[model samples]
Target: MMRHLRSIMRITWVDKVPSKEVLERTGLPSMEDLLTRKNLRWTGHLMRMSPNRLPNKSIYSQMPSVHRKRGRPRLRFKDTIKRNQKLRDIKTHSLASLSQQRDKWREIVK
Candidate 1:
């Protein structure tokens, strides 16, 4: 994407233009920011789902005990959500109540 953007603007790496400047010039959000926003939006959708729904239930489900491989444990969906929230400096404690209010959550996401 950076390469594409640079090409569109006729910028070469030799020009030593920073990627941040390129993104700003193109009026686009950084890839990380875009992903974080999507994650937050999905989390809000899950939070607003009916408790009996499968997607919502899966979020709160506990994994059963099992044998582990000789490597670092994989990150769960819950962990990813927490990481995204942390990146945005959002308070988890208030997320439940805040997410229920669509307008407020939309503002925060922006």
Candidate 2:
């Protein structure tokens, strides 16, 4: 008599998913078809390059001075005083009276 055997395989992250262009170049069927095939296998994760870390001393040394300008300076208007004076000279009126007159004219037209 004989007995059946089973085996397991480990996949690494370097094996990436196939792109559409690669599938087209290889003359393979749709991705769905490839995934459904009995022999098709894939690794679940992707590999990425490690990020570069700066030294603590360098990061602290590059701190901006508290007194120095951090960004673009604001625009200063020389005629601000004159502009405010002109604004103050303009007559103030109630907006409610203007709306009432407009409604009266519309009612007369209709």
Give the alpha-carbon lDDT of every model: 0.92, 0.30
lDDT of 2: 0.30
Q: List the residue pairs that clash in candidate 2.
A: none
Q: For candidate 1, lDDT tens digit of each residue in 1-110?
A: 99999999999999999999999999999999888899899999999999999999999999899998999999999999999888877799999898999999998787
Q: Candidate 2 on 1-110: residue-level lDDT in tens?
A: 00111111122235443355344545556544433221111100000112233332332244364575778654322133223224333112432232245454233222
How does each model score on TM-score? 0.93, 0.15
Worst lDDT run of 10 residues, candidate 2, spans 40-49
lDDT agreement of model 1 with the native: 0.92
Best by lDDT: 1
Error of 2 at 52 (Å): 66
